[model samples]
Target: MLYHTSPNYLSSQITDNDQLLFQKKKTNDLKEKKDAAKQKLAKVTFACREEMLKLREQKAQVQLEKLTKRKDKIERLIKLEHEIRELNAKTFMRIKPMHNPTTTTLYQNIVNIFYYMMVAIVILGFTYGMTKIAISTFDSLQNNQLTIIAAETNLFKLKEGVSDIFETKKVTTSYSFES
Candidate 1:
């Protein structure tokens, strides 16, 4: 009875050991699957980070190109403004007068000479006309005075003839009485 019982106890112990070994193998398989998943997640995160950096670099390049174009445009506008100012200055110079002082003075002198000559001629003509008028007036006054004297002498002679006629009439009458 003791020997038989010992064999039974040994068989039970071996079965229990086999069950523990199978459980340990299952746990190891689960742990390996979890580690593989973690590795895959890390690789994906690294790829995403690299893509974001590339996008940022492209944006910076585009901004630099825009700024360069704006600078070029401003420089062109400044050049154009400078050219316009120069043209305006040249035009103003051309528009200004270019008079010759000598020629202008000569023309003025000629005009003054003509004006003086005209004034002298007018004064001479006025003087000559006044002299002629004075001479004609003097001759007319002398003729009037001579005509008045001749008329007075004729009146005196008529008065004397009348007086002699009256005296003769009176003497004839007295002689008639004496006779």
Candidate 2:
């Protein structure tokens, strides 16, 4: 349908429409600026978060390295402590000399005495064994000499018996018969 309208009304409506378009353009521009601000804020927040994560990772790595070093030191300390304990538990004769003169003298004397006692015991045992061997040898020699004497006496007696038997046979025999 077509309707007749006044020029004043048309002109007023067109001006109003132009004002509305300007307002819309201004609002769109404001919205674009806000969007850009939001995007910038998000980027900044992401960057900050990434930096924090990196810092945290670095801190963790440093902490781990520190703990590892501490653990290594503790292990070395434990080994050294064990070695010290071992050294402390060892006898003086097994290692370096004692520091104190009196103690060193005492240790020396004790060691010397023990050594001499062991040597004396060994020598005495060896001498006793040798003496026992000599005595046994002499006893064996005496026994052999007695056995030889006994054997010689038995041989002489056997000869005498044989001679007596021959003499008896000779006396008992008569003259032989001629054939």
Candidate 3:
């Protein structure tokens, strides 16, 4: 066909060849439309894929954030556990020396230290388990799966354990919850 270029965006009128080409183009418009539709579909598919990749990346970021928080919490809990253990040992050693306190003081300190150690150990275990569950739930949330919904029950169990441990000590201390 005839070919031409414009200095600006304007164009020349039709020649015989241009007319023939225009006729041919009209005849082939249906095929062009089909080609256009196929191109549109390809573009849409690519767009969908890009969106999927973005979502996956977002999920990965969320997972990374949760992992970072869990790492921090784990480090703190480990430090606290270590400190409690050391304190328990120190308190035990100090209480065992009767020359240190002959009155009921040594006995009370020993009992308190033992119970405190037990509480710390139990709490540490629960903390680790809960952290693991929280990480797992993050995974499940990203994957759109079921997650643990037993936090209340677990808290109740911990409370019961605390009560049971102190039952024999006749400790009737009332605990208050803050909103």
Candidate 4:
């Protein structure tokens, strides 16, 4: 190939070199801007991750504190319930001893009085029955003795009358069969 060297072509070749140098400078500026943007994004991502970790730790701490408070409250409630039960037991003990004896004695005295009254009534009934039996027996014995006397008198009169009718002169004495 035969080379043709022209002055205009040589000037155009210098201008093309200058344009290439400008394009290269523009490319370097764009690359620096891209690198700076990437660095800013990396910093922002790291800060966000750190803040998220801090939030998680704070939430865990809050939950732990809540659990501890709940446990303390439960313990206090249990202690209060136990104290109440103990107080109730003591009160019952004191009241039981204080009240039981008087009522028991009262009931026992009433029962004793009733028993004595029943015994007296039974004794009186027995005495009355015995008196009635004695009175009836004495009355029957008196009536029988009177009837025997009457029968003896009748027998003596009849014997005298028969003796007179037969005109008997036998020697007779009073018959004595009494022992």
Candidate 5:
């Protein structure tokens, strides 16, 4: 199995082997460059997509805040409108104030009548109190007059008795017992 080849055959075999190795090395280098380009493009695409998503999220947040404020404002306006309607309904519910003729005159007449009635009652009460006081004063004066007349009659009787005793020649006798 140790058969020797000729020199020509050996040189041809070496040249063919070197050509194949060179071709293989070229293909490997091309494949490595293509892989590097693909990796770089993938990284760039990923970064772009991430930035787009972040911007979209920020825009959505701003829109949500605007929507929330708008909703609150609408609710507040509706509440104010409801309160205004209730106030108007409550204040204007009465029909008499809206259709009465000379309402001012009627109101004033009523107030005046009440005022006069109260005045008359107060005057009557004062007159009654004054009449009671006058009657009591007259009774006290009559009682004083009667007392004065009785005292005068008593004094006259005492004077008469003294005159009678004087006319009878009354003498005073005195006796003393000494111990």
Candidate 6:
């Protein structure tokens, strides 16, 4: 009876020890799983933050580019406007001559008269040159006709002389025959 009681007590003590060890092992495994999960979550959060920062930087860069483009456009427009203003000022100066209307008109009229006079002179010179050419051509043609007439007259005189000599020879032959 004493041995049986001792064995029962030893068995109960062993069971209690096993249960405690099992509970401790389970707690340790759970803690390890929680730590791993926290690490994974931390990595995911860090990646998300980096991505957000990159996106923000890209957005800022795009905005800066847009602003620069707008600034350039505005500057070009301003330059063009300034150039236009300068051109207008120059145009105003050019038109200032019209402030004295009578003088401007008189000058313009003088220039127009000169231009017309030059044109008339050119036309008169052309007419004179053509007339000279025509007169010279007429004179040359008249001279050629005179030369041809003179040649014809000389040829006629030669033929008459030859006929007269032949007649004289016939007369002489007749006298000789009579003798």
Q: Estimate each model's TM-score.
A: 0.40, 0.47, 0.39, 0.43, 0.45, 0.49
Q: State which candidate has the highest lDDT.
A: 2
Q: Candidate 1 or 6, higher lDDT?
A: 6
Tell me the alpha-carbon RMSD of every candidate: 20.1, 9.5, 39.5, 17.5, 13.2, 9.2
- Residues 1-179 of candidate 3 have per-residue lDDT tens digits of 22345523223344655777988898699789999999999999999999999999999999999999999999999999999989976666456443344434656777766877998999999999999999998888856532234665677899999889899556666677899
lDDT of 4 by residue, 1-179 (tens): 12336777777878888889999999999999999999999999999999999999999999999999999999999999999988965654333233245323435555656777998999999999999988988888888778878887888888888877655534444455888
- Residues 1-179 of candidate 6: C-alpha lDDT, one tens digit per residue: 67757987779878888888888888888899999999999999999999999999999999999999999999999999999988965654333242344334445555656777998999999999999999999999999989989988988898899989999998877653453
Model 1 stretches astray by more than 4 angstroms:
1-23, 93-96, 100-179
Against the reference, the lDDT scores of all candidates come to 0.73, 0.86, 0.79, 0.79, 0.80, 0.83
Candidate 1 has a TM-score of 0.40
**Which model, 2 or 5, shows the larger lDDT?**
2
After the best TM-score superposition of candidate 2, give how far the Cα of residue 128 lies from its true spot, in angstroms.
Answer: 39
Which pairs clash inside model 4? Answer: none
lDDT of 5: 0.80
- Alpha-carbon shift of residue 132 in model 6 (angstroms): 37
What are the per-residue Cα lDDT tens digits for candidate 1 across 80-108?
99999889656543332233233234345
Ranking by lDDT: 2, 6, 5, 3, 4, 1
Model 5 lDDT tens row, 1-179: 22338777778778888888988998898899999889989999999999999999999999999999999999999999999988855644421332344334545555656777898999999999999999999998899889889988998898899888776655553557899
Q: Which candidate number has the best TM-score?
A: 6
Decide which is better by lDDT, 2 or 6.
Answer: 2
lDDT of 1 at 106: 37
Tell me the spans in candidate 4 whose CA falls farther than 4 Å from its real position: 1-4, 89-179
Q: What does the lDDT read for residue 171 in candidate 3?
A: 68
